[model samples]
Target: MSIENTLSEIRDINLNYLMLAQQMIREDKPSAIFRLGISKDIANLIDSLSNSQLTKLANAQMMLARFRFDDCSILNMLTSYNKDSALTNAHAVMLMANQPVEAIA
Candidate 1:
C-alpha cells in the first residue's frame, strides 16, 4: 500500500531472515551456506553479528536478503502450475544448486 508500510515490511523480513540465518548457521554451517547461497565469509560475518547490529542493519530501507534466481526459466518452472509438481520443483532446485553463491566484491 504505502511506501512507509512497504519499507517497514522489508525491515521485518530482514530481521526474520537474519535471525533464521544465524540459527541455521549455528546448527549446520555447510548446510546453511548452501541453503542461504552465501559465501563462507558472508556466513561468518552473519554468524558473528550481535543482535543490536542485526537490528540496525535490518532497519535500513532496502531489503538485506534477495531471491537466489534471476533466471526466467527457473522462476517460471518454480511458479508455474504443473501436474508433475514434484519433478518440476526438483528441476528448479537442481538449477538453483548450480547457480553461484553470493561473494563479497
Candidate 2:
C-alpha cells in the first residue's frame, strides 16, 4: 500500500521506520536495518511503479532503516536521482560522474 495508507492507519509505524532507520544507522548496527521489512506487507499497495522502482523503494526502506540515516544527505541525493531517472533520459549524469573525455567545459 501507499505510504499514505500506512500512515493513515499506522502513523507511528512509518514514522518509526524513518526514525529507527536513522537511529540504527547512527548507532552503526547496520545489519539491524532489514528488520524494517516487517512493514513490507504493504508493498502491494503502492502503485504506478515499474518492477525496478518497487525494488528501489524496498531497497531505500532497507537502507534507511539499516543506515539510520535520518540526517542523511544521501536520502535527498537518492530522491533527486530517483525523481530524475523517472522523468529524464538514462544518459544523465552528475558533473562529477562525467568522464574527462566527456567534459565540455
Candidate 3:
C-alpha cells in the first residue's frame, strides 16, 4: 500500500480510538483510567477535548492508542488460547493491575 493510504488508515484508527476513549471516560472515569492505563490527568484531558480538537489530534500520522502490556508474558497470556479461559484471563488482569499507570510528562 502507498504511504498516503497507510497514513489515512492510521488517522482513521486514531479518530476511532479517541472517540471510544472519550466515551469510556465519560461513562466511567475510574474504569476508563484503569483500562486505558492512563493517569487521571490524561483522562481528563481526553475527556475535555472538543470534536475539532479530536480530529486535529487524530490527523497525526502516528497512532494514539498503544498496547498497555509491555511484558511478553502478559501479551502471551492474552493471545494464547487455553481451555481454562476464565482463569487465564483473571491471571492476566491481575498482572496488568500491578502495572503502573501512564503518567503525563
Error of 1 at 79 (Å): 1.8
Error of 3 at 41 (Å): 0.3
lDDT-based ranking, best first?
1, 3, 2
Models 1 onward score TM values of 0.90, 0.24, 0.93
Q: In candidate 2, what are the lDDT values of residues 1-105, reduced to their tens digit?
A: 997665454444444454544454445433332333322222223223455544444443322223323444434554564655643333322321332321111
Tens-digit per-residue lDDT, 1-105, candidate 1: 999999999999999999999999999999999999999999999999999999998998988888989999999999999999999999998899999998755
lDDT of 2: 0.38
User: Using alpha carbons, what is the TM-score of model 1?
Assistant: 0.90
Clashing pairs in 3: none
Candidates arranged by TM-score, highest first? 3, 1, 2
Better of 1 and 2 by lDDT: 1
lDDT of 3 by residue, 19-48 (tens): 999999999999999888889999999999
Q: By the lDDT metric, which is better: model 1 or model 3?
A: 1
lDDT of 3 at 70: 87
